[model samples]
Target: MKKRIYKDIKIRKLFKRYEIRRRLLLGLINDLSIPLEKRMEFVSQLNRLPRNASKVRTLNRCVLTGRSKSVYRFCKVSRLALRDLGSQGLIPGLSKKSW
Candidate 1:
């Protein structure tokens, strides 16, 4: 799990470095005005980037427990951790609602 987080962070850093280029290539690849051969070249260049650098490759982990599943992106935490913190009143503006 730790290794996964480390790898995710590393890939994220690499992605940041190539982000602008990736977006530009992606845009060019989709542009109809670009020649088919040039578009193919852009596609190949995009594919040459490390697979891990793609945003889809990164797994979201809980900020408190480092759990990789059931993460709430808005809160940046796992449901379990969020529930625990809310119950404890440690998470501001969050609480356990009772019927």
Candidate 2:
């Protein structure tokens, strides 16, 4: 789990470093007014970027337990963690569901 989190952190950093440049290249590549040669150049530039720099490489992980599945993006934790926190009243505005 720690390994997964560390890998995610590295991917996030790489994505941050290349996000703007990648988006620009992609946008340029897709523009119909751009010359074919220029678009190919943009494609080459996009391919030259590190694979991990792509946003798709980033995975949602639980901040407290490092679980990867069922993570709540807004809370940055997994489902179980969210439940535990809500039940303990640690999360403001979140309450445990009771019958």
The Cα local distance difference test for each model comes to 0.86, 0.91
lDDT of 2 at 58: 91
- Each model's backbone clash number: 0, 0
Candidate 1's C-alpha runs over 4 A off are none
As for candidate 1, its clashing pairs are none
Worst 10 residues of 2 by lDDT: 90-99
Kindly provide the TM-score of model 1 when superposed on the true structure, using C-alpha atoms.
0.87
Among the numbered candidates, top lDDT falls to: 2
Residues 1-99, model 1: lDDT tens digits? 777778778888887888888899899999999899999999999999877777787788887788989999998999999988888899888867871
Model 1 C-alpha lDDT versus the unseen true structure = 0.86
Alpha carbon lDDT at 60, candidate 2: 91
- In model 2, the runs with Cα more than 4 Å from the true position are none
Model 2, 37-82: lDDT tens per residue?
9999999999999999998889999999999999988989999998
